[model samples]
Target: MRAIVVSEPGGPEVLEWREVPEPRPTRGEVLIEVTAAGVNRADLMQRQGLYPPPPGVSEIPGLECSGVVAEVGEDVEGFAPGDEVCALLAGGGYAERVAVPWEQVLPAPSGVTLAEAAGLPEVVCTVWSNVFMAGRLRRGETLLVHGGASGIGTCAIQMAKAFGSRVVVTAGTPEKIAYCLELGADEAINHREEDFAEKVTADVILDIMGAKYLGRNVSALNTGGRLVVIGLQGGLRGELDLGALMARRGSIISTGLRNRPVADKGVIVRGVLENVWPLVAAGAVLPIVHEVVPMADAARAHRILESGDHIGKVLLAR
Candidate 1:
């Protein structure tokens, strides 16, 4: 099997395509013939030596993929060879084949293409767990999402709206903001030109910029607001006004999917499959794919994700 491997930390150029042994399914796992994999910020961070795979996991960088099952291991049931599925991988997705836990795999929604389904797992699990489960965004509440044109951002915007929440978003430019609005954001602000804290009212904030937006996020929140920081695209350190948080009775939460216990991710995967898969199959929620590059061009896919110009998910097709 051909896989993308990084021998040393660097840039996208560090990704090397080479032949590697095919992975076999272990107990409760399934071997998949990879069809496509989603490119994520975590992959770039791993390439740059900022993030490492969890202990006992594959060192490959990809985090989500869609494919057909090749074989099922002992204790794995309800899935068989030739089943069309997409999975949230902890690691090792940038290959022609991978072994994924059965708990992390879900049947691909009808009407979704294999390449597009590759883009679903990470964003879906992240948004549902953080925004709805953790952040407690509720109907009629105002929700703000940073990086509105991003894969997670787009998914968050749609799901929040679909659940009757008023969604607002911030993006780098007017074009990106417009794209966010097109994807169901009720309000879209150009972070480059506008002070979102002063212009918009938010009951909950789904932030990707972390330190860069911390102060403004605190200022923008309504009373009892929940602020969930999921990424650190900007610098990771910044000043926070504890006074503002206390006055508003706001709460701050942060989490990352990678490096978490497999049991925890498995629970999230099962919850998402039960709660959100119906929305996907019904065409109410969809994976937004910006580009699809061949697996051998994994370096190009990484470049596109790191460029910050893509409006949605970038996929590497096997």
Candidate 2:
């Protein structure tokens, strides 16, 4: 099998296409013949030596993939060989094969192509866990999403809207703002030009570009609001006003999917399958794919992801 292997920590140029041994499924896991893998911001972080794979996980950078099940492990039920599946991974998605825990897998949504399904797992799990389980976003509440045109942002917008929340988003450009609105955001603010804190009102904030939005995000929240920070695109260090949070009874929670215990991710995957996958199948939520590149062009895929101009997920096809 040919896989994208990083020779060293550096730019996308360090990613090399090489022949590697095919992986086999272990107990409670499944070996998937990778059809497509989603490119995420975490992948870029890994390439830059910022995020390392969790202990015992593959060194490859990918975090999510969609493909057909080649084999199933012992005691794994509800799935079989040849089943179309998409899975969340701790790592190793940038290959032709990936062995993923059965609990982290979900049946591909009806009417979605294999390429598009590759973009589902990470965003779905991330949004569901943060927005609902942790953040407690509820019906009729105002929700704000940072990086509105991103894969997770787009998914969050649709899911929040589906759950009856009024969604607002922030993006870098006019085009991205329009795209977010089309994806169901009630209001879209161009973060590059406008002060999003003044333009939108929110009871819950789902943030990706963390420190950069820290002050404004706190200011934008309504009383007793919750803010969930999932990424640190604009550097991790920032200044905050404790007085504002104390006065408003505001709370800030930060989390990441990678490096978490497999058991915890398995639980998140199960919840997502039960709560979010159905919405995807019903067309209430859909994967947004910005582009599909061949697996051999993994470097190009990484470059595209780093450019930050893409409006949705970038997939690498095997």
Which residues of candidate 2, in runs, are more than 4 Å off?
none
**Model 1 lDDT per residue over 197-302, tens place:** 9998788899988998899999999999999999998779989999999999999999888777778888898889888888888887899889999988899998
TM-scores of the models, in the given order?
0.98, 0.97
Among all windows of ten consecutive residues in candidate 1, which has the lowest summed lDDT?
Answer: 257-266
| Candidate 2, residue 86: how far the Cα is off, in Å | 0.3
Instruction: Give candidate 1 misplaced runs (Cα > 4 Å).
Output: none
lDDT tens string, model 2, 1-318?
A: 889998999999999989988888999999999999999988988998988998888988799999999999997878999999999999999999999989889898886898799999999999999999899999999999988999999999999999999998888888898899888899988877889988876899998777888998999989999999998877799999999988889999998888777789989988988888788889999999899999889999999988889988999997
Clash pairs, candidate 2, are none
In order, what is each prediction's RMSD in angstroms? 1.0, 1.1
